[model samples]
Target: MTTGNIKPTKEKKSRKSKPVVNEKSPLLPTKHEEDAAGFDEFNGASFSGAVFNLSTTIVGAGIMALPATMKVLGLIPGIALIIFTAFLTDASIELLLRFSRSSKSVSYGGLMGDTFGKYGRMLLQICVLVNNVGVLIVYMIIIGDVLSGTTSSGIHHPGVLEGWFGVHWWNGRTSILLITTLAVFAPLASLKRIDSLKFTSALSVALAVVFLVITVGITVFKLFSGTVLMPRLFPDVHDLASFFKLFTVVPVLVTAYICHYNVHSIDNELEDNTQIKAVVRTSLTLCSSVYVMTSLFGFLLFGDGTLDDVLSNFDSNLGIPFGSMLNDAVRISYAAHLMLVFPIVFYPLRLNLDGLLFPSARPLTSDNARFALLSTSLIGLIFLGANFIPSIWDAFQFTGATAAVCIGFIFPAAVTLRLVNLISNLICHQLSFCHLKESRFQFSLK
Candidate 1:
């Protein structure tokens, strides 16, 4: 992840991407890459920057739900599912990248529009709208949950501010979330580029690591002290219903990896688009590692006591010295992490929403007023939803999860399977053309 020494050169921009295999080879710089245009904006993002943005996309509220998933599926199956999902996610993204390059589409929506029709593009857009906005709203709610405690069973849990400074008008949920939106989310979201959030994305990933580190530390301490016993490594199944219930984690697993929408954007902005596949691999590797460790240690620490949202589980006494302080640290750090993640998610949401509504309009970046209108509208909608309609979060997550399945797994697989022969023929034609062009150049030199 260290990016200090490995500098990417951008001053000598190339009109065409380097061949994928070799200069003598005719496999890549496929029709799409040959026609790919460089952005005239700021220099493209360094490799690490792209990795951070994409990793942020993949690791959202879903990470908090992973520990709970492990509780249901057990460590063995749980870890297996995580790894398997990561692989599937990798393949799905690969499909999107491959088909996108072959089809000459720049965005996910465009790819869909190319592969299918306008209706297909519209479907992907709607799904992204639901998924990203729901995720952003839930992020706001989680922040509120951390900074201003939530109530359940007629008991009110204390938030960091409430516990420390006592409840005040300023520390109320709406007040705190509003301040957070203005102070953190607004400026980051306002940036015109996804790579602009690179540093914040890196920090966000670091905060996630902070949470993971603390969780592992607490678990290790408890293990050595012989206070917390080893948890079950398999699901405790008895009834037929119990056996069927294990499938419920599928949604969580799928949602954990639904980042296909933003793949093209990141790839679009990379200094070298060819490195996008490597970026995907690195991001997935880093995120999946965090996910596996978090699931394992978090399940070990809380065991049966783990809640659907494990952040809530942090409110209780954790049977260690300075446990209360560590609890606050974990919650607050992750809250801040989500704050950073806001913009990375918001970027694609804005892009897709714009493309959905204004398909024929100029590029969003070139149209300042259009960009502002979309950004403000989306943020306002999310802010109001976080404060007013929090009850629908469950429903939103369900529908969003469904849409995410389509964006991540279903659509990519369909594009690949349905158009295999077409792509093969396209590749053959491109290859023959490349071979002929190479021969003419050689003959001319002779």
Candidate 2:
């Protein structure tokens, strides 16, 4: 009956469609939309996967040195600093996530670029490169130590391979590292997305847990058997120089929690982006607990005599059941864990390098040859550094004091302050504008 009136309804629908078309008529998506697509490839990671990956990143070779840090800072201060670093780390990452979401920056470099311009981006990239390289070198060094053992003062302590097979060409540090790089690490590093390595990350975390459990178990066994050494609750300060030296441990603690750079990347991969904060909190909490337990028990097992590398402490024969077997298990398992961790750390390093060198190019993950070459070169350099470097502690100190501090603490704080300033300025400008408009209206009425 009123088919003519139906024409008005159709016209009304057409008019409504015009505004919808205009609303979305932009030539490009918004920054957040772009970020969503940019992050689409690796968005398969679950909350648990992000937690495990992040936990693995936080609890790396640093844990082995923590007991030594505890030795320097003593039990109370050392434990305090560990928790303190975790808190700062959580806060800093929350800053990172907040800024990341606001700016729609997916990577650390991208965030720096948005905040501090191109040079800021370069600085972040440099820091990440130095820090990740140092980490990879430490991983290789530990792997070499585990597989081929080390010699000091004309005494030879056999590594797992040497202990198992005696002195052989194949069990040599160089040989073992080469074999490992070629056989295991290179292949893993070739993976395109961080989410793809979640299984390995989980395995790495499990191995670290195994290492921690072994340390705690050994310490407990020795304690109940009345063989455990009493660790100092405070450092023995002799001279002012010695007292000041305690501050050195702070850098190591800072470095231990230097997962800030990867937080954005992990956040981007979350199945639900809103869960980033929860994932970060869970990861930092888990890593902090693991670090405290490992360091406390390791120190209890070794006391002031604890070596910078806790694994070295195990070199001396422990008179327990399967002592030698347990020793090898901890060493080998941790080394393997470091091997798995190498790729995760390397992931961001490679991405940063790609962004720096080939900013306009397609994603490295999409460019097979470039990714392979980049991985090979970086890993090769790391292998050389590992061979040449005498101590992971020294590497940790340099990277921690410089790059780790900058990336983990300084940058996040600076960015947050910048954002706050911008927001304050905007609010003030809005208020000023309103006041001016009100004054103008009053004058006009008068």
- The digit string of per-residue lDDT tens for model 2 on 308-336 reads 77886676788899999899888988988
TM-score of each: 0.85, 0.90
Candidate 2 regions exceeding 4 Å error are 1-43, 152-156
* Lowest lDDT 10-residue stretch of candidate 2: 19-28
**RMSD in order of candidates:** 8.4, 7.0
In angstroms, give how far residue 379 of model 1 lies from its true place.
1.2
Model 1 lDDT at residue 243: 94
lDDT against the true structure, each candidate: 0.80, 0.80
lDDT of 1 by residue, 247-288 (tens): 778877888888887787777667688788999999999999
Candidate of highest TM-score: 2
lDDT at 261 for candidate 1? 77
Relative to the true structure, candidate 1 reaches a TM of: 0.85
